[model samples]
Target: MVVFFDSLQGVLVILVMIVIGYILARSRWFSPSSSQIIARIVTQIALPMYMIDTITKDFTKQQLAQLLPNLKYPVISMMILFGLSVAIARLLHVRKNRRGLFQSMFFNSNTVFVGLPINMALFGPSSLPYVLVYYMANTTFFWTLGTYLIQRDGEGTWKFDIFTTLKKVFSPPLFGFMIGVVLVLLDVKIPTFIASDLHYMGALTIPLSMIFIGIAIEKAGLRNIKLSRYSLGVLAGRFILAPILMSLLLWRADVPQLMKQVFILQSAMPVMTNAPVVAKLYGADADYAAIMVTESTILSLIAVPILMTLLQK
Candidate 1:
């Protein structure tokens, strides 16, 4: 009962933040262009700083080393989920314009925006290391295969470019993770002032991200977000199929209970908030991607609580 209330509180807080954003956007206090700027800030600066601060402050070399062996679980699970997503997209006959969006939604969750806070709320700060482990796998897949899928679907072609894919895979957030790990492993002492500054800047990630989602929802227009065959199918895969698959994958794995719960909750998270940004940048169906992000997030208010509650049982 306590776990249920905690999970419910966490979900409600997120929903309230998102609602605040929506109201601001709807009232014209925040323009659509403002969302673009916020996205850049979140992705380029806030997110990376958050990664560095969280990892450096909370994790140690030995703890990281311990996490290394268990890292394979998230990576393998993500890979399998991505493959299954592709198959499902094809089976659903999701239109070409939205095909990549569909597949990306399935695998790349809003790990940072929604996943981080919920994990902390439910499992406490000690779960940061495990959360980062999942982040590594999520980032790896998003930049490489995730990018490739969106690009291909957007372009309506299968032209492969190894160099391009490699470039995308080593994104700024990934660099932040790598640098944090290196610092810990090398036992490099970051000055107190610098660490404090990073934390201050990093603190913007969650609010900014939630606001961005709200702006996206306003732009997508709530009334327009109907349950089309495509949207319904994507939602089913995201909220229903993905969680079950992740649970089965981790059922027999020998990991901490918290880690398994975190992983499963993350798997059940809404589609990545950045999905539309990536879709737009890569010439995929930006409209469809935005709708998916917004709809999944709104629906997650209900879905995530129920999912977490059941997991506790």
Candidate 2:
């Protein structure tokens, strides 16, 4: 219990950074548009750099062989949990109009935006391969499998173009993933000067993303909106219940300690921000998606730290 509390201290520092961003956003020191630019920069530029740097520096055949036996545990664990979360959202009786948004909420997480930094900070360079694997697992699943469930039976009166959705898989960050893999495969050597510059740029991704999250929350007016029990229920499922249940199952399955921690931590993360984007595109409840992302994000400060403390022990 004492160790748990001490580990919670690390989580608190991260929460404080988010709170500072929120305060700045509410004060109008930064506009939502600018905050979005920060997110875009991070997502399009900084995050990809981080991914490239991590992957290019570390991947090797021997490491792959060692991780082969355990790789399925974390990746499959996430797929199952994502599935269960969506099933619960469907079961909750959210109105038909809102169901797609709610389902997307459960279908995705803020892993790339938030999870990367936390993993890097807490576990250091040692967890880079797991991070890469997690990225591949989550993004592949989201663009392909996750999209089908969201658009398959919707009332949008629109054609569900799997091709267009598949195009999203080649997003800038993902393209970076491909480039990173190529560099690793060819054993491309980055010079000291260029590598150092990219590393410096990559460092800004998480903090900038957090600021964007704050600005998004302020613009969305989550605090002023009336909370439905249903919304709260969804948030509870994402932030509170899901991680605990999933972590236990993975632990019992004898997954590696680092991968177990990564899975649990990612599960504890807030609902994905781009969920609203997907909702709007698919003619779902964009407003509800915005609300879920905001509320879950705020609550995750409490939820993640508590869950981290519990699991780390």
Each model's lDDT comes to 0.81, 0.69
Q: Write the per-residue lDDT of candidate 1 for residues 1-313, one digit (tens) a residue.
A: 6767777898887778888999999899975489889888987898788888888888888877888677787777777877887788888888877787788788788777778766776677678777777877787788777777888767555566778766666767767877888999998989999999999998888788888878888998887787887888778877887788779888998878888888888877888877787788778888888888878888988887788888988
Alpha carbon lDDT at 37, candidate 1:
93
Pairs that collide in candidate 2 are none
CA deviation > 4 Å runs, candidate 1 = 155-158
TM-scores of all predicted structures: 0.90, 0.85
* Model 2 lowest lDDT segment of ten: 147-156
Worst 10 residues of 1 by lDDT: 153-162
The deviation in Å at residue 1 for candidate 2 is: 3.8
What's model 1's lDDT at 100?
A: 73
TM-score of 1: 0.90
